[model samples]
Target chain A: MKLYALNMIQPVGEKPPPEALDKVMAELAEVRRDLESQEAWVFGRPLHGPEASTVVRLRDDEVIATDGPWTEGKEFIGGIIIIEVEDLDAALQVAARYTRVTGLPMEVRPFQGLI
Target chain B: MSVLVRVFGDVDVAEEAVQDAFAEAVRRWPADGAPPSPAGWIITTARNKAIDRLRREAAREGKQAQAVLVNVAEPVEEGVVRDERLRLMFTCCHPALALQARVALTLRLLGGLTTAEIARAFLVPEATMAQRLVRAKGKIRDAGIPYRVPEEADLPGRLTGVLAVIYLVFNQGYGGRDELAAEAIRLGRVLAELMADEPEVLGLLALMLLIESRKGARMRDGELILLADQDRALWDRGLVDEGQALVRRCLRRNRPGPYQIQAAINAVHGDAARAEETDWRQILQLYDQLMGVAPSPVAALNRAVAVAEVEGVEEALAVVDGLDLGHYYLFHAIRADLLRRLGRREAAAAAYDEAIGRTENEAELAFLRRRRVSVCG
Candidate 1:
């Protein structure tokens, strides 16, 4: 068995239009329901946008805090879902379904170590 | 090895126990002569060692798997050892591990090869190979990958992966690493003996034997000898006989597969009394059948070469020109040979340059350069 993380990433500082968001939410609910029935879905939740992110660094004797993300002009994880499956193919199928409903790129990575 | 793994319920611990049992044998076998049942002795000793190790760990952690350990430590039956090794092969070649890892694990555990030897064969740092083996073993342990042979329905897919690893080991050995070739032969022989009913297994053993027989004459001094230029007397006739016998056995089964077809081709090559006596028409027919089943570009390339030998250069050249193997070094090399035979010197020289550019093998590059000079100069 394997656990894969499907990270839904989108460009920073961007949001879907309200009507598109509604459509996606509806589709996602149905997807989540199907995944739940299959016992494939473990957990999923939307993430806070990049504006609320913070960065911290330890310099010499002081800890410095910054207001923005560590990097800019890039796609950031907008939400994430975890799925347990037998192999990569099963994980890929789940990712493809999520991509169809969410209209965002989903990066599927296997969770290392026992899960 | 698989029996030990199942008994211990952990690959690392089982391997360590087996190693300890071998060490014990080394120390005791010389003085005590030998045991009546050597394999049974080793299995019993390894089981005891594993139980001791488990007891030590359990005592430290206050765990109670000691009862289970005691239960599994009973001497395994002799009849199960062969089946256990088959399961071990399936686990070692499990698809979850990386391809290189599969090859490394198969060589290490099944072939009894040292990590250093495997690293040298692959030209990787010893540390990297060690880490790869560790990671693969860890995956097998943590991912709950069952250490057992696949069922009849799953055997085809699973067995193919095992055969591929064995063949890869053989090819690596064929590329000037003599020990790897020997190791592959040993592993192949084991597979043949254990799976005697499986035609492909016999076919693979025959293929390795036929190819390995020619290795003695493949090189003269330090120079590579083309097949036609090799001294036929130097070939290992015993291996050739054995390989031909295996080919006949596979043919009698009437279950033709790629490996069986390949073994038959080599048998044809090995059967020739002299280079000129090679039955190119029969080879071409076998290659046609091979292309039908396997359908790889390399098979098509080999078939074209066979065509050149049996038919005319023009017919073969037309076949080669239709192939989309421009990036492959052997494709260019064969093209150069065909063009040179057709008296297209300038085109042949160009093809040799492409072949040289694509190849990194020092010996092969030297051969190509010599061919280029003979053609263009």
Candidate 2:
């Protein structure tokens, strides 16, 4: 088995309808619970909006600080889930299902080195 | 390698253990006599080696995945050892890797050639080949590419990649080295046996055999001899018979593919007892079928040659002129011949000059230069 990071990407200002959001949230909760019970879920968490993000860099031994995500991309990483799976096909299926439940586009990338 | 990789689920560890097992075999086999099943012995030893290595690593990392190796007690079957080779072939031909990387990895993993040897064969630096292997291996591991042969639905697409790699190996040897050609024939035999029902596999085997059958007369005195000028008696009749037989078998399947069509075309050439006896009309039809199924400029170029034989030089010249293969040396060489046959001496000489400029092989350059001399003179 290998661990994959499924990063949820969401538009910065777009929000679903109140009822749609509620239903999606409920489905997300159920799916997460099922994954946790199956021991496939390793860790997961939602993130604050990109406005609250901070960037820190070191240049020529001088500290520099900035606000916002790394780039000015319209969509930002809203949340992420880590799961242990057998192969790329399994990881892709999990990512697709997660997107269907949460209404968020997901990017799945495998972690290097075995657990 | 495939069995060990599946068991360990890690390319690096599987490779190391297989190497170690081979080393142990070299040390122990002479004294104890060869085992009844050498492959079975190696797999068992490699599996034990992997388990031991994982056990030691688990003590340090304490990971759950590493701990799972403690329960690895699957029986090693001889059938699995055979199937695993097919699995390895599929993995090497995975579409995710670049074509060059796929070919290099296949040569290294399945063909059992060292990186330096592969580099030499492909005319690249050893370091570049080494890096390509490392990168391809890393990608396979990080992407979690499964080490299993594709399902029935994906076989056609995946098999194309495998066949291309095999033919590339054959061509690499066809350039000069007999050893590489012989190895490719052996691999082709294995593929033909394993994929007995595939018409294209049979086609590829037949094509390789037909072309390689002329190895003895393909060259003389370090110079490439044109097919028309080569001594017919030097051709290997045994190989020609076998190749023609395979082509006949492919025709019976009634499922024509590019490779099968090409093999059928070569079979037509093999049927000729002398150069003047060649049935160009039959060859031209096969090329037309080949162009329909696998249309490429190279195939078109070859079709033009056959057209010249069946049709006149003017007709063939018209067909060749329509093709977009200005950079191909054979295109220029063939054009030169067509121009010469049409009595356009200066144009033929110019085309031969272009052919000599575009080619890399010393023998080919020599042949082209000789053609240029005759055309200019």
Candidate 3:
């Protein structure tokens, strides 16, 4: 089995209207159920907005902290879903379902040394 | 190599094993008076070499090599070897890889071209091409891109990528490299044999063969030769016959795709004995069908060229001017030719400048410059 992290990318600001967001959430719930039925779901959760992030770096044995996201961009990673599947094609199928439901891009990356 | 890839599930390992087997053959074949089944002998030798390598790694590492070793014991079936090649083709041309990477990998893994040769063909530094191949292979291994043909449901979509890679290689060869063009035709034949019922595969093979038939006359003294000016006698009659036969076969199937339409158009061109005798009306109809099947500005531009022949330059120029293909060099070149035909010297010269500015090929630049000079005078 291979573990893939499907990172959902979304615009930085302005939430969708409640009605539209609710419909998407409902569709996503169904997708989650399908993944669970297939026994491929590992874990998944929405993240707080990028404003909630803090960056910490160590340079020459000295630690420094900075505020905001690591790099400012129009789009940011909004959530991540990790799934255990046989291969990339299977993981891509799962990601495709999520992207279709949400109408957003998903970057699928495999975890190293986890196959 | 494909069989070894199937056995080992690793491209690097398979490649190394095949090279080792060939090296052993070179050393022993002359002295031992050649084996009765040379191919089988090589496969057996490669398999043993792979097993030894895996065993050494298993001892050094811990578990991964041992897992691969377990599959090494399976007997190689003759029928499976053919399927293995198809599987390798699909894997090498997977859509997840970049387009250039897909072309390079197909040439390297399937065409048996060396990295240096591929690099030279592509005009990239050898190190750059080597890095590209290494990165692509790493992604395939790390991402667990399955080393198998896609499922039936995904076959059509996946097959397009494979065909596109083959066509890209063919076009690259069509520019100047005869060997690359031959390699692309060989790959096309292999694909046609494997997917015999697929009209698109047959169509692609026919397209390459038809184009390749005219290769001998495409250049003269390192200068580009327009099709209308090419000597028909220079075209290979055998390849023309073969390509036309395939197009006829496609017509019988009656499921016309973009490639089949393009091939049919070429077959029509091949029918004419002289340049003036070309069936422009038939070619225009094929281009119309091609546009309907797969519409693009490039196809629209090509159709306009045929329109120039069947109709007039004025009508063709109007069609060409309507399209938004500023970035494409051929669009400007064709427009310049139409303007030149209509006696619009200044405009023709300016359009030729646009074409010359956009193009990178030395022969194409020379042709455009010569055309521009004629219009100026």
Candidate 4:
């Protein structure tokens, strides 16, 4: 078995209307329930917007801190879910389901361990 | 190679073992008479070679290599090799890999062509092609792209990727490399046999055979010849017959797809003994059906050529002008032909110049240049 991280890519802009967001959240909850039933879900949660994020770095043996995302972009990682599956294909299948429910893109990457 | 890949589940190890087995054969086959079952003998020898290599690696790597070695030690039967080849085909043509990588890997692993040879055929540097093959194999291993046929639910979508890769290889061959075209046809035939019930597979094979049948008449003196001007007598009758038979089988299946429709159109053209005797109405109908099934700017441009024959040059030109195909040389070439036929010499000359500027082929450039001069006169 392998572990994969499905990072939800959210656009950095005004939020959708409440009615639309409510429907999406309901569908997402249903998807989460499905994943839990399959015993594939490990961890999942949404994060605050990128505006609330801070950057910390080390430069010349001195610690540094930044006020915004490491790199400014039109889209940010708004949420993440970790799942255990057999292979990339299975992870992709799960990611596809999440994307369908949330109407957002998901980047599926395998956790590095066995080369 | 396929059998060894199935056994070891590692492309690099499988490839090395197959080469080692062949080297062993070259050394011993001259001294001893050829074995009755040469294929079985090679499979056994390759399997043994892979086991030896894995054992050596396992000694250094410890547990991980030892676990893989245990899996590699299983014996593979010769009869299952055919299925293994099919599995290998699916893996090499997996949708996860880029199209160029898939084509290069297919030719290398299944076609048994050297990287240098594949490089020459695709017009890429040997080092670049070698790197591409290595990256593709690494991705397949790292991404855990399974070396097995997809389940029935995913077969249609996955099969489309495989067929597209084969067709792309055939088109690359059609450009100038006859050997690549031959290899594509051989792969198509193997696919057809393995998936005999698949109408689209048969359609693709027939489509290639029909186009290849006219290869003898496609060029003359290193210059391009239009299909209408080619000598019908030069066409291979045997290939035409075989291709037409496959088309008939597809027709009986009553399942229509883009490749099958294109093959049917070619079969229609093959029925004509002379170019003037060609049935424009039937060809146009097929194009309409093709557009319905798989609509694209290229297909629309091709459909315009048939419209010129059936409807008139004015109507065809109207359709061509509406298409957003400014970047395609064939779009300009077809527009030039239609304009010339309508006595619009100035417009025709400009369109011919567009085609001349767009195309890079020496033979095609020569033809376009000659046509451009004729328009001026």
Which whole-number lDDT from 0 to 100 does residue B363 have in model 1? 73
In terms of docking quality, how is candidate 4 classified? medium
Relative to the true structure, candidate 4 reaches a TM of: 0.95
In terms of docking quality, model 1 is: incorrect
Name the lDDT value of residue B128 in candidate 3.
100
Per-residue lDDT of model 2, residues A23-51, tens digit only: 88888888889888878999988989889
lDDT of each: 0.88, 0.87, 0.92, 0.89
Pick the winner on DockQ between candidates 1 and 4: 4
Model 2 complex DockQ against the native? 0.61
Q: Identify the superior model by DockQ, candidate 2 or candidate 3.
A: 3
RMSD of each: 4.9, 5.6, 2.0, 2.0
Q: Worst ten-residue run, lDDT, model 3 chain B?
A: B65-74
Stretches of candidate 1 off by over 4 Å are A1-115, B61-63, B66-72
TM-score of chain A of 2: 0.92
Higher-scoring candidate on lDDT, 2 or 4: 4
lDDT of 3: 0.92
DockQ for every model comes to: 0.10, 0.61, 0.90, 0.62
Q: What number of clashing residue pairs does each candidate have, in the order they appear?
A: 0, 0, 0, 0
User: Which has the greatest DockQ?
Assistant: 3
Deviation of model 2 at B118, angstroms = 1.2
The value of fnat for model 1 is 0.00
* Candidate order, DockQ descending: 3, 4, 2, 1
